[model samples]
Target: MPETKKFLYVNRKAPYGTIYAQEALEVVLIGAAFEQDVSLAFLDDGVYQITKGQNTKEVSMKNFSLTYKALGDYDVNKIYVEQESLDARGLTLDDLLPLAWEDEDDDWAKKDSIKVVSAAEMAKIMEQSDIVFSF
Candidate 1:
């Protein structure tokens, strides 16, 4: 069997304003198809990618908040939001979308997709990654 490698995508920008977040997500979606162990880290302004109540109507852009929710369906469920990042922006889990995925190990039960961790903790995760894509 091919060894499954760990892939980590580091997001440090806001969802809009720039294309980095969207492009990173697209890469993650494609990479997930390989069944590799994938994880996403939302740091700095990147935490806003999952922020709830996103409306792009005024900007004439499609709301992609739902895209984050759809990630679970692709089995890309390991989303980590940095605590310091959220605190710095005065945001909380309540301000983010509630993303979940099916846990086959738990008899296909649904579980939350987001994991809030400290910057230090996220660094540890980054260290374990076999491939790290930073945006």
Candidate 2:
């Protein structure tokens, strides 16, 4: 693989009743397929992606939540969650996507994080990206 360029997909909305989440997920997966270095940082309501125990089937909707788990298969290894968003929603790290992480890997509990991030920190990631797509 050549030196892959970094691409960041920022998911900034809820996963239901909107195409933002779905589209963002698509870009991330396909970007990886092209051999780009794809990473995702979920902020604001986007943290819902990692919310534990979702059952959208009650609303007669297909469960896209599990699609998040498949990110690794596409080689999208960087997934970030904003800590303040989780707290603002009264959600603990425990109530988030099962694959949460920290830089130090304190939990090592899942394949991905429970990694907490901040807006400014997210901006740093954005600045470093060869392409930044926000949805």
Candidate 3:
């Protein structure tokens, strides 16, 4: 069997007004489908991608934020949100979508997938990744 490598998808853009966030989401799902060890890092304006109550009606765009909830199903559970980025945007954990995964090994218990970490911690995570995709 091929050795599984840690794949980190780093998001650094806003959720809307561009294609970066959407493209990153698609790539993450594709990577996860390949059974790679996938992790996600949200920093800078990227934190907005997972924020709760997104309304893209006026912009005539589809609101894909809720799509993040499906990541857990793909086993892409390591979602790291930068604390500094949230603070800068005056947002809290409560302001983001509640993402969780079902642990089959633990009797299918639901567990949270989001981990809010400091910028330093996020950097360490990036460094530890065998392959990092930034958007």
TM-score of each: 0.95, 0.82, 0.96
Worst 10 residues of 3 by lDDT: 28-37
In terms of lDDT, the best-performing candidate is: 3
- What is candidate 2's TM-score against the reference? 0.82
For model 2, the local distance difference test gives: 0.74
Q: Candidate 2 or 3, higher TM-score?
A: 3
Full ranking by lDDT: 3, 1, 2
Candidate 2: residue 33 Cα off by (Å): 1.0
Better of 2 and 3 by lDDT: 3
Q: Tens digits of per-residue lDDT for model 1 on 30-62?
A: 888899999999999998888889989999877
Question: Could you tell me which 10 consecutive residues in candidate 2 have the lowest summed lDDT?
Answer: 100-109
Please report how far candidate 2 places residue 2 from its true position, in Å: 8.1
lDDT of each: 0.91, 0.74, 0.92
